[model samples]
Target: MCSFKKVSPITSTGSLLCTSWKQITSTEVPAVSVIANNSSCFQRLYAVLEALSGVEPGEDVLRLAHKVQALPNVSFKGIQCYNGWNQHIRKVTDRQAAIDLVVEKTRKALQILKDNAVECNYITGGGTGSYVFMDVDYSNNLDESGALVTDFSQSLYVLSTVQSVVPGNRAILNTGLKGISLDSGVPKIFGHRDLTFSNGGDEHGIVRPSGNLKVGDQVWLIPGHCDPTVNMHNWIVGVGDQVWLIPGHCDPTVNMHNWIVGVRGGIVECLWPITGRGPGV
Candidate 1:
């Protein structure tokens, strides 16, 4: 009843090819459409045809198009053009140029499909790193006003407990590399702008205290990258008198845990199990 694309390695042109095609047609799944946004993908389409039919798919685009159209339940979908650089590009002009290139490439692909009488209906591809918490990497993107985009408010935080108080205005937290991620940058202390958080060790985080922090005191930290940080924890405490940790990324974070605890007015409202927690689920 549903259609989706599955990318898998094509090992052989014999049984594996027939099996792959039969597996799709034997199920209730709808026909899949091909995507050829670049020259490599275009060449791969011909390679796929040659493997299935045992006939060499030459450089003739029209011949390849006819071979694809002759398939039982397969259709040729349009191109997918993506510009990764534009997702986090700081300058407006540079981002615009990247977008222009994506458009140009997409148009050229579409034109080829049209000239060859290939049915291409979908043109899909564009993504943003910016999400709910707006991690450090996404913060670098600038708006047309030449200032940082501040439309979305950050809602994710890592709640940590102070484990030790050392000299030189330094305090150690229970959170560290195992509990938080520093791929983008070090975490920031929430509600304490003057204080700084640094990687201490595998299970410890060093912070320059604001003279008020002490052992057993809890601190909220804004993660540099939300995806891996959330993956490190099993639970996300909702809003309450107790500290709450909101995940930066939703999809991968949800996949890392088995259950989602929903709370309302400090009471547990519902619990949903994540049946699909990993690949091959």
Candidate 2:
């Protein structure tokens, strides 16, 4: 694996004057090199230049690309051309227009690189907001049929137990602000369409119109946002005879736990320690 420390120079107009890239790894990991099957010591860097080029002058983009290409131990893989606004576009025409703009900008950037003799081999961009079921934020995105897209299944749920009940009106759950995140929106009850979830406090969740639910009944909640919610939990219970819990977000969520418990047929299969946990990891 290779890491680059970013150092940016800003212009008077708040545009990027240039970006400096420095490779911190002196020796390459043999495992990574073998997996890649590449003998070159140079690491590939995919620069997110679309946003910069869109905001900065064209000359600045060219200059930045040239500087990255000039780095000795780095290979400028290519540029990532994307618009974040496209992810939430509900109309097909509007989404197409956004994609067209991204294509135009990407072509312009590629032309500039080719003219300057900068070698660019690949281009990558776009996001999975339209393809995956992650949160309430993605629930509004429309497909070609003008209906909501449901390309992926939602497999993540927060298993919480009811601690208190108020008859037909409401029920209090064990999960609250600390158990789940509310930045995107309130979590939805997995099977109970009539029930709504709200933050009760640090240690409780409010379920309105609780219906037939009573104390000790388990509630499966679909998190509004999965990233921070996964960061709040230590264990991800897997499915089998035992309850299964999968992380909504993998990278940062794994950093919060000490071990990954793998199970098979309701039995403990293996244990992997998370060596890269805590700050700066």
Candidate 3:
């Protein structure tokens, strides 16, 4: 509850896109459109965090002075690193030493995230540089590694199966990503036994060398990438405690929808107003 130049924050898309404001009475501060709706808020946020890194608030005063008396035995979390206002990563001068520091810091940040597991989507704030240099800590969980996103391509498989699944043959599989899939995102095969779905040119899936297929068996084909795969489908479906319909691309797809949808217990529900049937918002 200390007074700085002024702002409180809020975000709906992500904490990344969030903004804060100080209390403003109508008589004291006029509501300004520019500050409320744009990127200026981001710059302001950087300034505040940067300043806080150097200045101890009231609660830290005793701890601060005690450390001052001890002369250099302490480090503060609120201290700034490098440039005050950037979301980019920097190369470390000494790799091993920097790695040591990062491991120490991330171990704690991870604890904070686990504690807030029920309250946040992500506890994110090291820039791109931080992501590469800073993420390393754990007790007993296998890391899934970073996620790789790609566009839809006519060639290649997100998941590939041996067209030759001969029983006595060696196990042939090329894995790009390994983990659980929410829906497992299997591409749809319109109507052929040999599912021939390409990047976007050929309609039916390319039938590889005969992998003996019995009637009604499923082959989960991964798209060359996600974006075009999303476009190829009538809709890209997400299922979870948190299911959602995200646009693959907003502008082109906005006019194409006749209705909007929501889900509850595996059922799709239309939630748009009746007037939504008419175009042009």
Candidate 4:
């Protein structure tokens, strides 16, 4: 049974209304509880749950959900918790532990809902980065050439040319933190695996070359975090042929672009406009 209503407003203010609704829903129970003692604004049929630990969410969220569901005139729909902090662990075992923790917490909440006789039909695990598998096994699958085996994470590349080389095996590049995200970590130099990249500032990057690298030589950087990095740019230039860019974080990156362009043989093929652009306040 689908207990959650997929509501959509056909107006520009739809998103704003939805955001406001979430806030209102979260706080309405407390306000109603206070009012129920004196006035008939609402009936305090369910108990108001106290706050639990800051890191782990508990019955308090479900308490609010129960209250919302009890509203006479309002349509009742289940909640969707949008938390995915634990899903970003690099190690597979660590990632599994994180997911298990989330599931454990979810199980507690579901029990609370069951006790309250509240129907929760839908629940979401996470958005993008949480579910993305960084390491993929493509051992059996191979191209017809038989020499090429596909790896998942080898997609996006920040191609830049070497600007200058200084003493102590250091080389300066034309891109830095402003061009790509360093939140997850610094990007590694593609091809020159021995070379390490460090932040020089917003507009510059320092590359410590393990081998000889001359000026004007090509250098490709694999981004540490792909979301904010791609958001910092407007257009993606494709070089030789068709390329599929897989983002480290897909949700935020998708919001950064206004248009998606398709190019073939160095010629513009098609363009599609993106509806949403997330702005930082």
Off by over 4 Å in 4: 1-56, 70-76, 81-83, 126-151, 210-275
Write the residue-wise lDDT of candidate 2 on 129-235 in tens digits: 53322655556568888988767644334556666665445667776666566665676655445557777998877776456555444543333222322323322
Q: What is the TM-score of each candidate against the true structure?
A: 0.56, 0.56, 0.20, 0.54
Query: Candidate 1, residues 245-277: lDDT per residue as tens digits?
Result: 332333444554567655444355687797887
lDDT, candidate 2, at 150: 67
Q: Which TM-score value belongs to model 3? A: 0.20
Q: Could you tell me which 10 consecutive residues in candidate 2 have the lowest summed lDDT?
A: 235-244
TM-score for candidate 2: 0.56
Distance from true position, residue 193, model 4, in Å? 0.7
Q: How much is the lDDT of residue 232 in candidate 3?
A: 38
Q: Report the Cα lDDT for residue 246, model 3.
A: 23
Model 3 lDDT vs. the true structure?
A: 0.28
lDDT of 4 by residue, 31-94 (tens): 3333222222212222222211121357775656655455442333444555556544445556
